[model samples]
Structure formats: structure tokens, C-alpha cells
Target: MAAALDIKGLKVSYGNIQALRGVDLTVEEGEIVTLIGANGAGKSTLMNTVAGLVRTREGAIHHYEEDITGMDTRELVKRGIILAPEGRQIFPDLSVKDNLLMGGYLRSDKENDETMKTVFELFPILEERQNQMGLTLSGGEQQMLAIGRALMAGPKLLLLDEPSLGLAPIIVSNLFKLIKRIRDMGVTILLVEQNARIALKTADRAYVLESGRIVAADRADVLLKSDLIEKSYLGKS
Candidate 1:
């Protein structure tokens, strides 16, 4: 089977500062692949580049065997490449339902009911607060709203950036559980996470990035036990 997402020698830059330097990785279908790194390690940059929010300076991005390098973000969305960005970038003034509706903007109302139903089932609170302004929700609720909104797009490949950021430990645990649930539902995931421990724990495969390049790649379980990973990211020797 082909990879759900494949990136080859992917490089990106902002002015003269390079964000990604020949990064290569792949996410197979029906897998949760995590990219773990420090703040400036270029994980988020790679996500945005894949999502078409950032233009690449070199290399290629392929989704399901088709070359999609430099595809427009809107075009990428139409192709089932959906991104729930690092920050919960929901429409603050819109009602929760409206925000979700925006995610399905490419679809007609008649086609989105089932997707909405799935989103609601995954997040019952979304149904309870359907009419509430997005800004009124707490942090965890906002994060749920963000993921629900992405689900509304009927994504084949989901790119989640920092889904655990800023939440409490318990909330983060619950959030990762939901992420695994999402994968079980058949949407392939490419996750970029700063919380390396949970990221490693939840992913099927993991990549460690450093200074804009991939330094290590392995099965999540194996990577979790490595002395380098334990000391560097897991805070133990």
C-alpha cells in the first residue's frame, strides 16, 4: 500500500533562515505518525508546508502517490487534506455550529449531516453548546471544537499540530485518547507534538527532528525505549 502522505527532501525557508532542510518522512494509511521535536525544530513548519499554508523552497510532497508539491491550500482542502492548526483558530464570533459549518464550506448542506453527526458523537459537548459563541468555551472545549471542525471536512488525511498544547495533564490524556479514536475511525493522522512522551506513546511511528532535519525515525514503541529518547525527551536516564 502506498503512503497516505510522503515527503521527500522537503525544504522550506523564511527569508534566509531555513525551516526545513531536506526532511524526508512518510505516513502509511491507517497510521498515526508523530513528529517530535523542540520549539524551533521545524515540526510545525513541516505541517504548514504540507497543508499548503507555507510554500516550500525545494523537494516534493506526495499524497497517495500523486505529487502535490506546492498545491494551493484550498485545492489541498478539496482533496481531503485537512489541517487542525497548532492554535485553535476557530471563528471567535461565530456559534459553535457555524464554526464547524465553515470547515465543510466545500460541501453542500445535504452532504454534511452525517459528518456533523460523527463530530457530535465524538464530542457531545459540541451538541450541547452548538449555539454558543466559540470564544465562550474553555480551552479544552475550544480544542475539541477545533478537531470537530476539521472532522466536518471529511478529511482522508488529518494533519494535527500540537493538539495537546496548553491543556492540563488530564485533558491532554483525554485529548490523546480521542486522537487514537480518530485514527481507529479510519482517518490517517500526521501529528506534530511538543509533548514528546505522549506523542511517542500514541503514535504508530515516530520521527525526531532537530535543527530542521530528521534525526531519527522508528516504531513508536522502540523509540520510546531508546536511551537517547528517554534522556532527551522523556526527562529520565
Candidate 2:
């Protein structure tokens, strides 16, 4: 089967400062593919490029075999390509439920209802505090809301940027479980995370970005056992 998402020979430039150099990546249907690297590794830049928030300077990105290299973010969302940006880009004043509804803005069908139900099942706390203001939730709850909102779109490919940021270790662990559950339900994911250990352990496959280039790519477990990983992100034992 074709990949849910495919990025080939991707090169990105931010006014002469190249962010991605000949990057090639794929997310198989229902797989969790994590991009792990240190700061300035261009992981976030890769996500933005895939989402069409940043146009590609080279290479092509395809979703379900359709080229979406330079499409609008709204159009991509309509096609079930959703990105839950880093930092939980939720409206502080809006209620959590309302913010989730915003994610379904393009949907007029009962599909979103099913999606919301799944999201609630994944994070019951979100359902419990449905009417709470987004700003009122703790960092973990806010991150849950962010994932819930993205789930609202019922995306075939979910692009997540640092879902575990600023949360307790326990929360991060539980959150990764929910992510796996989503994958089990047949949603493909392309995650960019700063937490190397958790990401490499959870994802089936992994890529390591460094200074705007892909320095490593392999099965997650392979990366976990690599000396390069210990030298770069994980300290040596």
C-alpha cells in the first residue's frame, strides 16, 4: 500500500538559511514516525513544510498519492491533513470544547461527531472539563486539548509538534499511550519531538535531524541503541 504521507528530497529555505536538506520521509498507514533531534534541527520546520504553512523550495510532499506540495493549510485540513502546532496553539479565551469545534470548521457531517467521541475516549478529562476555558487547563490538559482539536478534523495523517512539551513525566507517558491508541485506530502520525527517549521508544521508525539536515534514519529501536544517539541527545550510560 502507498504511504499515508510521503516527502521526497525535501529542501526548505528561510531566506537563504536552509532548514531542510534533501530530506526524504514517509509515514506508513497507521504507523507512528517520530523525528527526534536537538534544538535547531529543523524538525518543526519539516512539519510546517509538510502542512503547507511553509512552501517547499525543492522536492515534493504527497498525501494518499495526491501532491500537496504547495497547497493552502485550509485545503489540507479539508483533505484530512491536520497539524497540531507546537505550544498548543489554542485560543486562551475560548472554551476547550469550542476550540475543538474550531478544528471541525470544514466538516459538516457526522464524521466529526465520531472523531470527538474517539478523542474524548482517549482523554476523558477533556470531556469532563468540556466547558472550561483553554487557559485554565494545566499544561497536560492543554496538550490533550490540542490533540483533541486535531482529532476533530479526523485526519488520515496527523502532524504533531512536541505534544509532550512542558508536562510532567507521568503525563508525557500517558500522552504517548493515547498517541499509540490513535495509531492503533489507523491514524498515521508524523511527530516532531524534543524528548528523544520517549519518542524513539514509542515510534516504530525514526529520523534524526541535525543543523537542518538528516544525519540519521532507522528503526526507532536501532536509533535507541546507536552511539550517535548517546552522543547527541541521550547521555552515555
Cα displacement (angstroms), candidate 1, residue 9, comes to 0.3
Per-candidate TM-scores read 0.98, 0.96
Clash counts per candidate, in order, are: 0, 0
Q: What is candidate 1's lDDT per residue for 116-139, written digit by digit as tens?
A: 999999899999999999999999
Q: Candidate 1: lDDT of 213?
A: 93
Candidate 2: residue 174 Cα off by (Å): 0.2
The lDDT of each candidate is 0.93, 0.90
Name the weakest run of 10 consecutive residues (lDDT summed) in model 2: 108-117
Cα displacement (Å) at residue 154, model 1:
0.6
lDDT of 2 by residue, 1-237 (tens): 778888899999999899888998888988899998888889889999888899799999988779999999988988888899999989899998898898888887587787788888889998999999999999999999999999998888999999999999999999998899888888899989999999998999999998877888999999999999988888865
